[model samples]
Target: MDAYWSPLCTACEGLESGSVLVTPVSERPFEIEATRDDRIVVKFRDSGEERPLHREQFSVLVDRLEGSPITLETLAPGVEPYAAVLSLGPEFVSDGEALSLALDEAVGGESPHLLTPEEARTRPERVHDDAVLLADLLDRVDADDPSSLDTGTLTDLYVLLSDVQRGADRVRGTARNSLLERLGPDQQLHGRFGTVRRTTRERRYSKDDEIIFDALDEHDVPREWVLGVDPEKLDVVLAVTDLDEDDVYDVDEQVYVQKTGVDEGEKFSRLQGLAERLEEVEGGEAIQEDLLEIERRIDEALASG
Candidate 1:
């Protein structure tokens, strides 16, 4: 019948490192700290002995509350740990109090479920699902505006995806769909929401010719050109020459394609057009540029051409 009884008060034990200690007294939480001697200490406001309590007593105290909320606090220095006061709803208040007292009086018993730092860090499958979802979202956004993506937005998306990949599963599907919708083309064969895809075709020219033609095709004027040693190895390369004269001069591969260029913009518009035509293409396989490989191939073609 005592309002405050230490007999039923159970001490929650955590690792010698700072950990939350749930007590039965008024739902107040406490932290477990380690003494210099390596003994665990739980600091509580209610006056009693400051000695370490056995693990059994702690388990009993926690079990009595069931799912009730308790308040957690740190009484002494060096015992600062994250503690929460779990509030027991009205229905469980009396029962929770009784269990708390009983636990204080209980002798030795098994400890309640407590997670170590390592255990708490275990990666769940849900985390991976979140990652996949995030990646999909990034792809979608990239499809819409590759240059528009800033590091901050990418970081935010990465964090969300990482969280989902870590544990949040429900958001995965939504993230994935959002991404696909962003990447797909609109009815006009232009990307939805101002997004565009670029296309490029390469041709070969031996000298100052009237019109550069696809040496590979021998017929059509290629939208772009690649210089190579032989027709078979005519890899795609970007060529920029003085508009006044037809002198073909080698330029830095990176400089050839400006980030913002009329030619590049037109090429992306053309790609969007092609995408609309290939709507029926199945299995996700199509002519895709390996951006890195594309650059390498272009460089090789320029060096050889």
Candidate 2:
């Protein structure tokens, strides 16, 4: 059976304001604007636009969206400027009579997004959702006051801790990339609260069976440690081979819920290193000022750093 649209008509008919559907992982919100005969008006909430999706058009949109993936950090709901730009907050840009919204997809590298009118009025509402996540995590830890030996259940603690690390890494990775784009990758960026440095690390890996097997043979290493075949190649083999699949490989299928999004582990490590290198610079935060004054303050900050 069809997935998102299987209940579309029924859902729309049931609701007073048409049908609303959000994605499972990202909470990427989409809704039906209104019912029109055979078509349903659909759009992601943050998209600031709507689409007339034929019931069969779900796959096409999903393909486009997944093709142009945005970072998880940018998708925090109910935040200030983001919320306003998403049309979830108070208002949006207007061309006198009608409201206008940003139609561009918020995906890809750190490129300049056009300033929205909502930004100016809604700047003060900025707060990273990660703070709330971390706060909750800290609260849980404090409630139990568990130590390494005396914890009630290590499973929940381990899972939550890992999630917190990943969430922090996701935010830090986004911030690092943003700063790296503006500042040189080899340079340090001075912020109001902290300084961030960028450094390069080299990671090497190979997939060629010839080279891999030759190195293993030369080192007298057991080749079976790696199942004697790369998983990717094994996958291809499984698709076409005539042999019993179970004889070649054992498959175990287990289901579990997980937080879904991109997390660059290497970038996170680099960010963590940067955090370690941070020094406490004694000064007050620069007060809010006009554009020129802000520019001067930035220049002063850089000079001081």
Candidate 3:
């Protein structure tokens, strides 16, 4: 039976010259030869120790040359003696375009070389869906009057909103890092939070709270109502009075503020809501079906093992 060989095949690595490499096309093993010429001649190794393969039994290995730094001179010669050079056809050229074409064929095509837009789209579906939903929920909160929302509703919203924001941060961080690694540092940065800071009264309150208080007081009543912040695009500012001190804060009554822009906060909130909905949906029968299928596959694999 003819053997198959692929450079990328794990079995092909570290193969010595003159070693028999199988071609999947012909299912016959050919003796490898390293040549000083531009081409390496693949032939049947007829050592008395092993059965001598007939001429019809072996197929020639032809590689088109390109401008690749690799040349036949660099190939290590195998154990086979020089045989009459068999002319297959016109000489293969190593021009840039031809070389590229050869490489493309050797690797089985350029399709795997680059991702289609559809594949790229699938890559971000989970993250993008979460972002959109969070952005929508945030917009709803921004439009509503904080005073109109009751404490229970506010707490629930805050909890949901916070969860979404954190989730978004996690996804964005992972996706951004992945892109950066693949595309290099020159590409645009991908995450919502450009910078993050831990909120501390001591750090933000300045030497004189009176001076900072006065500055804030100059703003309108609604603006003055803002208390606490966590920085960046999320810029979470809350109507300090709306929070139930006992429920929202710890025993110390210390609540960390997220400083994010109003627009960004709105966007984040919508995305958060969407993510929550997706999780809820995923908890249903559809996801269970997927789990069942996975279980079935695992069971089948175990049985085979």
Candidate 4:
């Protein structure tokens, strides 16, 4: 039987927005049959087994369309009049004409408009939806005061968080366009651009609470663990943890050890000495047996010492 389509599938309304696209997970091919209320009905192509999943739950099955892959180098105002500049790959350099054309295509207007920190701060309306606000709310939630919000406020908080994120994305796209105009003709940009993972889901992060967001990690830290943090501090903490947006992890409260290849204590230094000795040996041929012995000792130290 053909999967029925329902006009009432409000859950799939984003299908019309072009922001969300659904595709089967590589392992299982599923056809989206219909959406109703907050649920999406999907039928597995192979098994013909149909199921209804909450829209929020089903969203993880698909991907959202983010903007262009072009990277932008964020610059300090002292270094450049613009907030950022186009960062083409090391091998590719854009001529002035190419940069101008790309900039025109990106913003459809004059050269990039740079925002000074003072200007940016004065015009709060421009960057209205910011992560700073979300961080503030989490702070309040952690305080456990009588005026603390009810449990239902979390939904509202998430909605606002999404709005802020979308606003930031729109701003970033414009910044990228502006930065493209700043690139000098044939200017080379070295270093690989970092990638960020974005998602519709939000997870709580706390610095004082000792939570680190890692890929493939999940945590169920209690609400009490949510810590208050200023935006700058939060940025620093995230940089240290290296957790970007869109990381989803299972919520586990247990601590686990991460292994580094080097052995602990004096053995690692001794291994270095052994390596230097091998390098000094004639073609490193005579010390091959000695090197092997040292490596064996280092491995034993790493494993048991």
Candidate 5:
């Protein structure tokens, strides 16, 4: 198969330039190119015979790939004028030549099942189960048979998979939080704070996190202690810790720290741990002054309070 740039449209007038891909379907290869108006032009690869199809002079290709991975249907003449490949997986096969070439190059090197033009359009409900449909699409790709799909379907599949992954992450997070609440009161699991923005220039702490840090400063909590706390939610993350020796307590509601720093360290050890933990947080490096500056600021905040 070969493809190149071509502006030849002798059979049609006033057509725009487009790309062309040549491939063989059965006996001969054909040149298929797109026009500026989004129409297709076909020509024999060897004989240079051109056939410009009218908009409705082609066939509709209904891709029922879920069940028959290697099969496609061709609409009967007069039913649809144009030929189109729709579904997910690969680029459209322009003509019979390309289709045949795809079959030849298919995974098993076997011909694809070309259904009758009358059987072209298959009902979606009639497709095999979801698993089978997905498997078929994957299998066809593995076999190097991409002519079964169009660009739109491929994008749709990509979006669907992305959504599924995000949904799964949310579910896992919920389950993990439930398990952590049962891990006892004295546990200090190391974790990081959330982010307000992802961009480097715009990244900052959430408003609630800002307020929590401010409250910690007002209560004279050490900077090291304030930076190392993590909570499942903002509302419950500000409670006093044993590290805060000011004897502070909430009479009605206690702060819930899902994770906190360890107490088995000297002042320097605690400062180092907090610095390391901060680096683990997203936007940690840019969150505050430099580490040396932060150390100095910590002492200043402590002395001033």
Candidate 6:
């Protein structure tokens, strides 16, 4: 299977240039050199050869990923995916490659499934019921510290929510387009589920910055008050004036944690089962080995939590 990339990945992460992209089948890698306004430049890792793709080629890719995570070969007869890989951002590029590779494999007909009538009928209902249960779980957690949750359980919730969110976005996007077809400009449709209104949103912006600034000047508006300080310009000012930064700006720095990886759910499930079994034991004491293993798992869970 070949890894693929899409501009849609940008919607998930903030992307910039110099991201690494690898070809799965060839085991060849490319480095993103620059992401300019009009085009993207990717350099071959070994050859030092650069390939530039125009922005229009990327537009074709933006919407393709949600339907099919594809490489250039499968995307179209002639297309781009390495170029699109830039969208995955530096942080998630490796993750995107593995994910897109799996998707590309499935798109190529690996372990494909055709749902049974029973499955087709019951699957959505089962999801809805599970959603209801999850909502109840969250409602209870909301009043308490969610941090009190075991890391494995928190990870499970994260995975579940991610899947549900993706499914919802896909379903709602399609339905929204379908509903749009039946409505007119400025028309409103009120239904039991929700009310939707279609209208043109107009925004006004200045095309000529100098002229706009002059107009503001004529209107007695201070240009500095009208516009924000450019950080680069502010840097020059600070250097020349030796101004105290604390007087000009309020500094705020925050500490946070982020997920780096996930362990297999099956392993966590088995650990949970073992813990439950220990809780249900007839005697006050359990085997030293079993208790030690459970304690180890608990320590690991908290370390990541």
Q: Which candidate has the highest TM-score of all?
A: 6
- Expressed as tens digits, the lDDT of each residue in 1-305 for candidate 3 is 02212222222223333234332222234443433223344454333233332333213333222233223223324311111121111122222112122333333322111222222232234344433443444445642676777775565456545544555466556754665556633444433424222222454445465666777777634434655544332223324345354554445556785634234445444544554665788465654455445434432332233
By summed lDDT, which 10 consecutive residues of candidate 3 come out lowest? 81-90
Candidates in order, TM-scores: namely 0.18, 0.32, 0.21, 0.19, 0.18, 0.34
lDDT of 3: 0.37
Model 3, runs deviating above 4 Å: 1-144, 185-253, 257-305
Give a tens-digit lDDT track for model 1, residues 224-258. Answer: 56545552323223123324222334545454322
Off by over 4 Å in 4: 1-126, 129-132, 142-150, 184-305
How many steric overlaps are in each model, in order?
A: 30, 0, 32, 7, 8, 0
Q: Please give, for residues 1-305, the per-residue lDDT of candidate 4 as tens digits.
A: 01112322432332322121212112233444665666656555456777665644323211110122222232222212110121111111233222222333334222222222222231223233233334334445743442566655654455444544555566567755765666555554432333223224588764532335331136554454543546687667767887873363344578854322322223323334555766896878654554345434432332232
Pairs of residues at least 3 apart in sequence or in different chains that clash in candidate 2: none
Model 6 poorest ten-residue lDDT run:
109-118
Candidate 2 clashes: the total is 0
Each model's lDDT: 0.37, 0.43, 0.37, 0.37, 0.36, 0.49
| Alpha carbon deviation, residue 135, candidate 3 (Å) | 6.0
* Reference-based lDDT, residue 270, model 4: 39
* lDDT winner: 6
Which ranges of candidate 6 are over 4 A from the true structure?
Answer: 1-148, 190-192, 199-206, 214-228, 235-244, 253-305
Candidate RMSDs in order: 25.1, 18.5, 23.6, 30.7, 28.2, 19.2
What digit string (tens of lDDT, one per residue) describes model 5 on residues 178-216?
656655555444434221221124667656777888888
User: Residue 1 deviation, candidate 4, in Å?
Assistant: 77
Cα-lDDT of candidate 2: 0.43
**Candidate 2 residues 131-245, lDDT tens each?**
2222333444553545642343444444444554554455456766777788875777776756767677899987797888888999999888755566788778878887568
